[model samples]
Target: MRRVIGLVLLLLSVSLSAQALSWAYAFVVLDGRVYEVMDVAVLDDDLGEVVGEVKTMADDMDGSYYGDASNMYPIGTTYRKVNGEAIEDVLAVEDESGWKRAEYRHDAPFSMRDHLDKVAYGFVGLGLVVFVMYRFRRTR
Candidate 1:
């Protein structure tokens, strides 16, 4: 029974440590100001064929979650349209330049931050109590 309890606690600690990396829309800061990522047009490169129509209209993007144009993807410094506000797949764009592919990672919703905060703090408090109990019991 003691071994089983220890295993469970170890597993829980490992799971918390290995939590998945959440996505966030990180803006590439330049020139001391946040410049909008303009359309990453595809040249005659093979990357162009991979990115579809999304690259052509990046300039017209209203925001990360809106507009007919595509949002900037972190996967590649290019434009990719996610159906609805949720990012889905990558797309290509075309213009006088050529073609290029794009993918975007947007900031995670606020709920994720709250949930992570709770989990992290909870674990810390639990660990502190467990350590104190173990030390006291050992001395006794």
Candidate 2:
């Protein structure tokens, strides 16, 4: 019984930790301003030239949950991207340099951030199943 409880607690702790990490927002400093990349997407093909690199990183884990983008876009790394056209609070940009009428499609690859909630729920569910199985076995 005690072992089962301990196992459940451990699983719960791990789930909570994953939840915390899921809430972390990746931020990037561009043009002297800090902008949180709402959706970190990877370009399918190399299109643009190296415009800028991540100069600094600040991870504020206090409560706001803002973190650095070193994991996805590491510091000193450069990628190809066309000029950015700000759309409200989001920066919509193309990945290659081409004529305005050129056809282009930017499809983002699979990202774990998109399914973090499901993963967290899976952890909790596994913990619950373990606890229930332990109780069932003791009763039997």
Candidate 3:
């Protein structure tokens, strides 16, 4: 029974630790620029060609809390993108002619900066409600 308990604890700890180290974001490089992307899909249609290869893989430590380019394409691996759409927000690449090589949905990472105003307003509203309740109780 003691051995079983120890095994359970060990497994629990391992699982907890693994959950803490999750990949938060992924990125790709094309034409000397880096793009934050999500929902990457590689289709089986031949409509794209090789554009560039991944020259470097971002390190996990490079970005805080998995925000870095760590979860990136493997180094030295070639990638393809749809022509005339490279500069746009979304990027789609192709490996050859029959299938879509890769498609990257670009979007900014979730940051407190983007929603600071909303958060501040929420806090202010909560405080106002609390203040009104306090005033009502005091009057009573």
State each model's CA lDDT, in order. 0.41, 0.44, 0.52
Instruction: Report the lDDT tens digits of candidate 1 across residue range 2-45.
Output: 99999999999988775433323323221111223336653443
What is the Å distance of residue 23 in model 2 from its true position?
6.2
Summed over model 2, clashes come to 1
TM-scores for the candidates: 0.24, 0.31, 0.38
Model 1 worst lDDT run, 10 consecutive residues: 26-35
Best candidate per lDDT, number?
Answer: 3
Candidate 3 lDDT by residue in tens digits, 1-140: 99999999999998776433344555665543455554545453522566565554554643431121224555655555555555444444322333232334444345453366578889999999999999999999
In model 3, which range of ten residues has the least summed lDDT? 61-70
Per-residue lDDT, model 2, residue 128, is 100
Instruction: Tell me the TM-score of model 3.
Output: 0.38
Better of 1 and 3 by TM-score: 3
- For 1-140, candidate 2 gives per-residue lDDT tens digits of 99999999999998887432333444444443344444344444533444445543443342221222332344664423444423223332222332111112222234454367578889999999999999999999
Model 3 CA deviation exceeding 4 Å by range = 1-23, 40-42, 64-70, 93-140
Report clash pairs, candidate 3.
Answer: 44-99, 45-98, 45-99, 45-100, 46-97, 46-98, 46-99, 80-93, 80-94, 81-93
Candidate 3: RMSD to truth:
13.9
